[model samples]
Target: MIDIPDSDRQLIDQAIFLPMLLTVLQRDLAAIDKGSFKLKQPYQISIEAIIRDVQKDLAAAKRYLHKNNIKIIRGRSENNFTFYMVMYKGGEEKRSYFNDKIRNNVEDLLDYYLVGRQEER
Candidate 1:
């Protein structure tokens, strides 16, 4: 097992999950655009704001990964677990995460971007 530093691990996690979060937000925005709603503007504006915030973070994560020569790849899934391969600093490590854990983490991130962080400002 290759040991990963906490900072790199955080960046790797962001690199893996931020794009997925963006995809979900984009799809949600598209659905809102297509659906008939009396007040779509508010929802659209909120989602757009969240998308911009996520994009900025994602860009930073990508830059960190590139500058540090780190790469992460999604591997095959088996049952309730999905595999990920991380290539960092001339070493490789395989990590497996439960599907539900990933979903929950993403949900938490969405909540933070949508509401939690907003309250801090």
Candidate 2:
């Protein structure tokens, strides 16, 4: 059962969220923290360049975190998964979906959620 949050579902169609998620995933994956427990960390990340990349594309992931600073942490997970922690001085935000499935669900969920909402009205 893949349960996607409604907010995320809405964002998928906004022409901003899906790309935002991918850019973030790509950016974060490029640079895994040094002390991270995962050897090879099951993922890769590059923090700085991503911010620069975002300027070209609004969905560069770090847009929201602009100058706020973003951090990634690999947590303890049994599966081949790398946990991501997006934080700032205020605290960390909440994410309903973290796995690759979130990316996959982008188009489908966007079509379903947005189109469906239109039909409902």
Candidate 3:
């Protein structure tokens, strides 16, 4: 087992889950983007506020992960190794298929930080 601080688990959870929030937000944002003619100004403002909050949480999580050197890429550290392995190693065939797919998904989450994008609260 990889050795990591308990606080790191919280960080890891943030890293993994926050982008999920972004995905939902982005989905709704897309709808708003397309239906801009239909949505009222106040509704758009509310959605933008939610996006800002998600982005703030995303930035904080990314800062913690970066400060700790826990990269989101595979083979970079024990954290990445565990994350990729736990996800990819369910079966032999499963491992071979997702080298890029799974890693890319994580990269997409990281991209949210780059572009600006969770949290339970």
Best by TM-score: 1
- List the RMSD of every prediction in angstroms: 1.1, 13.8, 9.8
In order of appearance, the predictions have TM-scores of 0.93, 0.29, 0.51
Model 2: lowest-lDDT 10 consecutive positions: 7-16
User: 1-121, model 3: which lDDT tens digit per residue?
Assistant: 4555577656665666566666766776677777847646765676677667667877997897676566553233343333332121122111122335545655565565435533423
Order of the predicted models by TM-score, top scorer first: 1, 3, 2
Tell me the lDDT of model 1 at 56: 96
Candidate 2 TM-score, C-alpha based: 0.29
lDDT of 1 by residue, 1-121 (tens): 6888999999899888888899999999999999999999999999999999999999999999999999988999999999999998999999998999999878888999988989989
Top lDDT prediction, candidate number: 1
lDDT scores of the candidates, listed in order: 0.92, 0.44, 0.56
Better of 1 and 2 by lDDT: 1
